[model samples]
Target: MPRTAAPPRTADLQARPYKPGDKVVAVVDLPGVPEGTTGRIAVADGLTWRRYWVRFDNGEMLGHVDQHALVRARDWDAFRHARELERAEAERAAETSAEADTDAGGATAVAAGGATVNGVAVPAHLLARSKAARERLGA
Candidate 1:
């Protein structure tokens, strides 16, 4: 059998000392963590005195988070990319309403649809359907 020597450790592979300007990953650990219940990991821009002031992937400015709950991010670049994708997906979903409206020549119209309004097919125009929807027997 042949023996191979172990590779030298690299600075990049080591956990960096916590720094105010350094990027970190926020982790939430429970008192009694159980299997399958994972803590949250988020990218933090920087740290404050005893906490971190960073923006979450959801764009909420989490002004302060416990320093003990944060760790040096394993891959900052990948984290940033994932966060961006998450934000973009959220924005897209928010802008694109699941409800459909009949837009005809820049104007909305009322029409029958698979959706039910007062047990009847909903109109294509969301607004019109809503207004007429109030006329339901028990609505």
Candidate 2:
């Protein structure tokens, strides 16, 4: 099989826009540093391959951390709020679409043999198995 080339890393000059003493929160887990760990930028290094040296509150001093792994502490709460609103809107839109489909002449109506998922027939046994799995997993 032929392998596809990885996406090129573009020069993101804005990556390490943080200055020394700027507060940031980890977006991903680092070695000995858990996600959401608040830290201060000790040093912002590199140009094309921007990285940071952070002094975390949990006593982890990590080096070469990229901007993708951190978010400005001031903006974290606003970012999370925006993301939650987007998700709730998406769920409401999906529910509205599903209801419209059901009301429009039984497009989503189930047949006698089994349940339908997105209008596709699912066997009764498979549906039962899925229900059992969900119950077992407490989902």
Candidate 3:
């Protein structure tokens, strides 16, 4: 048997604290990015420096942002609280609408081939699709 040489090692991989879906804020402007822009971590690579990809609030996707270039989003706690409030509001609205629909003598109203519950005009099918999308995105 012939001896084989070992493959050359590249950069050492390190584990990053942030993961996909984590909210982050840009600490330094790079190229088109400006400081203070909020974004979400789309991809995180621990193998190389500046290997993360960020999708900014303005719809710009930038890659290779180093860990030091970003920080956890400012007001992260407030953002979470706001989302919780929104979720609660949506739930309450849905409940109230259902109650109203039931109070209308159990009459099922259909408009343009879509069922109407309360005064909300959105189609049931569309609402289901939107709910599915939100669940998939973990939003």
Q: Residue 41 CA error for candidate 3 (Å)? A: 0.3
lDDT of each: 0.46, 0.76, 0.68
lDDT by residue (tens digit), candidate 1, 45-95: 443345545444334445555655554555544544554666787788766
Quote the positional error of residue 113 for candidate 1 in Å.
14
Q: Where does candidate 3 stray beyond 4 Å?
A: 1-16, 48-50, 75-139
Model 3 steric clash pairs: none
Best by lDDT: 2
Residues 6-121, candidate 3, lDDT per residue (tens digit)?
Answer: 43211111123678998887766876788778899999887555568999998889987887777677544444455466678789999998788665423433444445545545
Q: What is candidate 2's TM-score against the reference?
A: 0.50
Off by over 4 Å in 2: 1-16, 85-139
lDDT of 2 by residue, 57-114 (tens): 9999999999777778876665556556667878999999977765542432354446
User: Which model, 2 or 3, shows the larger TM-score?
Assistant: 2
Best by TM-score: 2
Q: What does the lDDT read for residue 74 in candidate 3?
A: 51
- Model 3 scores a C-alpha lDDT of 0.68
